[model samples]
Structure formats: structure tokens, C-alpha cells
Target: MDKANQTIQITIDADSGIPIWLQLRNRLVYLISSGGFAPGDKLPTVRELAVSLGINYNTVSKVYQDIERDGYIASFRGRGTFVSDAYLKNEGSAENEADSLIDDFIRQCRELGIPRQEISALVERRLKLTE
Candidate 1:
């Protein structure tokens, strides 16, 4: 099967002690929230995803069920699973929260004695790399 056709990308990290389900949930939430998968985008069936990821089908189903319960996706019988229309409902709030988190990170760095100039220079370097 073509890898590009799969909507979900699952990876097992050998080093991290985190449970596989939590990792899958985090990746999916980040991908959906970041617009990597737009609203209404279809996801692979739980069985197909399990087979592709080499994980148990029950694990894939549980992750999907949890995400759906959290309002991040909608699963319909026969129609398949899809990214929720509500995904973009609070985009502004999400942006504001992200900004606040970054602000907190910078403040913590300063509290830890990271020089302001050094921080600014590092940020500039990162921005330049992205550009």
C-alpha cells in the first residue's frame, strides 16, 4: 500500500517510556490542531491503521474512540472517520494559548539565567532556518 494514502502516521518510539496510545493521541491531536489534516479529512479505518503501524487493532480503535470523544474527530458507520468540523472552531483561542505558552517558556528560560540577548539570537537563528 502507498504510504502517502494513509492519513495517520504512527511510529513506535523505543526510547520513550510513554504508552503507545498516549503517543498516538498526542501526534494525532498535534497534526489536527496544526492543520496538517484539515476539517473533514478522512482517516484510515482502525484495522488498516493498525496493520500499517504494526500495532493491535484494539489499540488503534481505542485511540480513535478517545479522540472522537474529545470532539477532535467524528466517526460514522460505513462512511469512515473524519477530522471534526469543530477543529477550527476555537482557532483564535488556540493561537492565544500557544502565544501564552511561548511567553511562559521564555520567562522560565530567563528565570534559569538564560541571557535575553542569547535567547533573542537563538530565536532569530531558528526563524532564519525556517525561512
Candidate 2:
């Protein structure tokens, strides 16, 4: 795959009130966890990503470092960074993947200014509709 083209899928919202680094990191985590990126998939370099997103190189570098530490990606000395297999090992079942996705959803809801109680109520209502 052309890693450069893949960067098109990532976008930054300057008006979102969230930190740019957090936005990038969250998007990457979401992509990886949701299987938009598979294990061993090559990631764009920090410089390339920064250029593509029009952000400072240091910001992308920092997010990469943090995500690498979190075990979501691994960087080889010369081969570039790739999506880590850690999540594959950790999310061994559909249930576990669901749990991770739910955690992401809750975090996003909170970020959107939804209170926990309201989130719970919304979830309950949605579940009832399905039932």
C-alpha cells in the first residue's frame, strides 16, 4: 500500500477544542483497534504525517513515541513503524474487541460533553429499541 495515500484518511479539526496530539493518537488507536489497520501494517513516518496533517513535526513525533510506549505500534531501527500485534494478543475474542470499542465510545461521548448518566440512559434506550 502507498503509505502516503493512507494519510488521507486522517484529518485534523482545528475547531474541536481537543489537543492536536490527542486527536492524532485517538484516531490512530481507533483505526488500529477497529481493524482499519492490521498488524504489521506500515505507518507513515512522523515527518510524512506531520507534513500531511500540516502540524509540527515534533507533535507527530511525540504522539508516535507515546503510542509506541503504549504498545499500539512498534518502530524498527531501519524498517519504519508498523502496527503492533499486541492488541491481537490482548483482544483474543469478539467480546474483548467489543469491550475495547465500548471503552472508546464512552471516552468519545465524554469528550462530546455527554454526562455519564445521560450516556447510560442513551445506551439503555438504544438497547431497548434493538430488543
Candidate 3:
């Protein structure tokens, strides 16, 4: 994975109304699932992430611990933390994978009363801004 020198970017919303730890955890899960990181790829240290997010070190540590407990990542005492293989996406066609994911999201949105047009707008905007 060679993450020792890899650069990772995380966008934080201090005002998202969600707890920072939860937001960070979700971002990490998405990063792992969206192929932004590979299984076994090392993550920033707790201290590093805390400093990066301008939050208390314990907060980042807690998020890491929670995600690890959720099987999204694993920690090796000497080697550091990494994206766990359990969260790894299937290694097949990337386009097909993305389509499947999008379809699932759309299905959930439909059930939640989000119209197709609204979903399309949201997806397009998010893809442009976030991806």
C-alpha cells in the first residue's frame, strides 16, 4: 500500500451538525469504499489526523477506535492503522461497480421520497464538487 508517503485529503465540516468524529469516520469509510484508498493502505496517525483537523488528539483516536471496532479499519501497533480488507470493494470493472453503487443509492433515495430529478441534481452536484 505504501501509504507512508501518500497524501490523503479529508474535508471537514465544523458546522455540519454532525459530530466531528462521526463525520471523519464516515469520510474514511467512503474513502475506503470509493477506492480512494486500498485495503491495507496506512492511514494518518491519530495525532496527525487530529492536528490536521484542528481537533483534540483523543477525538481522532476515538474515531479510529470506533471505526476499527466497526471492521472498517484495523490498527497494527508497530505498523500503524490501515483500511481493513473487509471493507474492500470487489476488484472488477470500476464503472460497473460505480453503477451498482449509484443504483443502490438511488433506490434508497426513492424510498426516502427523494424524486428522481432531485436525486439527479444532488448526485451531479456532489459528483462535481466532491469527486
Cα TM-score per model: 0.62, 0.66, 0.60
For each candidate, what is the lDDT?
Answer: 0.76, 0.85, 0.75
CA deviation > 4 Å runs, candidate 1: 1-8, 90-131
Across 1-131, the per-residue lDDT of candidate 1 in tens digits comes to 33345443557674697667767777888877877777888888888878877888998898898778667899999899988966456566877558745775586568669998988887888999999
| C-alpha RMSD for every candidate | 8.7, 5.1, 7.7
Top lDDT prediction, candidate number: 2
For model 3, how does the per-residue alpha-carbon lDDT over 1-131 read when each residue is reduced to its tens digit? 44543434676788887667667877777777777778778889899888777888987888788668656789999999888876444445687558755765786688679998999999889889975
Question: Model 3: runs farther than 4 Å from truth?
Answer: 1-8, 88-131
By summed lDDT, the worst window of 10 consecutive residues in model 2 runs over 85-94
Tens-digit lDDT string for candidate 2 (61-91):
9888977866789999889999997756666
Give stretches of model 2 more than 4 Å off. Answer: 92-131
Q: Could you tell me which residue pairs clash in candidate 2?
A: none
Ranking of all candidate structures by their TM-score, best first: 2, 1, 3
Which of 1 and 3 is ahead in lDDT?
A: 1
